[model samples]
Target: MKRSLQITLLVVVAALGLAAGLAWQAWRDQPATVPDATGTPGSDARSTITSLVVGKRRPDYQLPDLEGQARSAAAYDGKVVMVNFWATWCPPCVREMPALEELYETYRDRGLVVVGIALDNGEAVVDFVDPMGIEYPILIGEDDGIDISRDYGNRLGVLPYTVIIGRDGIIRHAHPGEIDLEQARAYVEPLL
Candidate 1:
């Protein structure tokens, strides 16, 4: 029957799509490296990397928080700052938020500032953040988000990019991809 054949073809197509997605996931998960400004490949995902700006001071940025008030990076000067570039649509970015939130809550008293720069729009951002209990400042950056991310070594323009700056203002790490709490602590604790 033509109808049966059509259904079978649909199922086959779906399976192929899923296979491709899984393959991509596997590739991203591997210990991937993006080269530093000098073109030397890093040993792993979390490295002082791609931009010459890494190992330099954190860049100045002003963007509106969820409530529409302008926030300047200078406000958190002299603190250990983690700037995470994320979007609600990106699955890894969404998944990594809770850990970042936890890290913020734990170390804020010790002068740690976790800033989430969101690239996508809508009430869904507020909705997604509140119920999940994210208290760290979320800056909406739908307009200039990608450019800002690229400044700190997001050569691939990937979601869930993170840059950790020391209290002295030097960029300590620029990591592209998901980071676990353990990895976060390792990167942050010494600086704090």
Candidate 2:
């Protein structure tokens, strides 16, 4: 009886240790949270964003711009639109602002419309724009930001989410985090 009990204890300990090891390995393999458009880190900072696949109509919805003017997805019809969801607090988002602005300027004449959706409600966005020389339209999203993001397939509500809508109104690609300029340029130039 004593020998049997000792063997069972050993097995239980070994099983627990194995379980812990597996958990650790899984955690280590997880991706880091991406910062929002600005330099501020958010609670969902460590999540990974995936690209939107082809063959889907771009999610359409109406949102208010910074001045509270109603804007709809249809406003950019017949043109290639880049919709970027960002916050002034996200570091990565801020880091890529200049690049995005430059990309917009380079393609605006070719029917490229870059719209920035600010996820934060505070005055941070208002302050960040001027210094960054952001020429595109910036809109406030408030609490409805998450809902708007979900409509664009960003279920995790990650900042710096970008979706490219082709001229035909099809969603060409949706990036959940920061925009890759090279990839963005490649996708937009062809659509132009």
Candidate 3:
């Protein structure tokens, strides 16, 4: 009986050891997860940024605003333009709206045009934009905005993606996440 008990204990220990080994192996095989401001799990920091390379001509596309007025990259050509792709639902996106507004207010008259593309449905974007008093042209694309963003180099569909286009019509920088006032100054001051 004692021999049988010893053999059962050995089997249990082996099974536990095998399970641990498998778990470790699985963990090792998984890509590293970086914490974002949204606290989403399994979010890859690298994949969040698309089209990191600068000096490429930005793809041109036309989208309508909440008022149904057409806006396009070409319309703002020969000006230092900052095209920001954002969604109303994204916390980080909402957080940076004021900073963007400030940036636009400060430089709009100086040949800097800041365009906000809102990726939201129906009147949701209008409702959000109205109270915020966003001065720059805001184009509404809804879900189709995802494809537009991908075309602009936001392959991961990340919110709060910004691309700076020099007056020469070349992309100077494409970045993901919220832009602080200082970063905004740095990006636009040189182009201005």
lDDT of each: 0.81, 0.76, 0.81
Off by over 4 Å in 1: 1-51
Off by over 4 Å in 3: 1-53
Clashes of each: 0, 14, 0
Best by TM-score: 3
TM-scores, one per candidate: 0.74, 0.71, 0.75
lDDT of 1 by residue, 1-192 (tens): 999999999999999999999999999889966433221236443343535566787778888888989997888889999999888888878888889989999999998999999987736677777787889999887768788887777767767888898988888877777777877888899999
Candidate 1: give its CA RMSD in angstroms.
9.9
Global CA lDDT of candidate 1, please? 0.81
Candidates 1 and 2: which is better by TM-score?
1
- Model 3 poorest ten-residue lDDT run: 37-46
lDDT of 3 by residue, 81-151 (tens): 99888888888888888888899999988999989988887599988899988898899887777887887
CA shift of 75, model 3, Å? 0.3
Q: Give the TM-score of candidate 3.
A: 0.75
lDDT of 2 by residue, 1-192 (tens): 999999999999999999999999999999987445321233233223333335578777777876678888899999999988888788868877887889999999999999888888837667767677789877777777667777777766677778788899987866666666786797688889
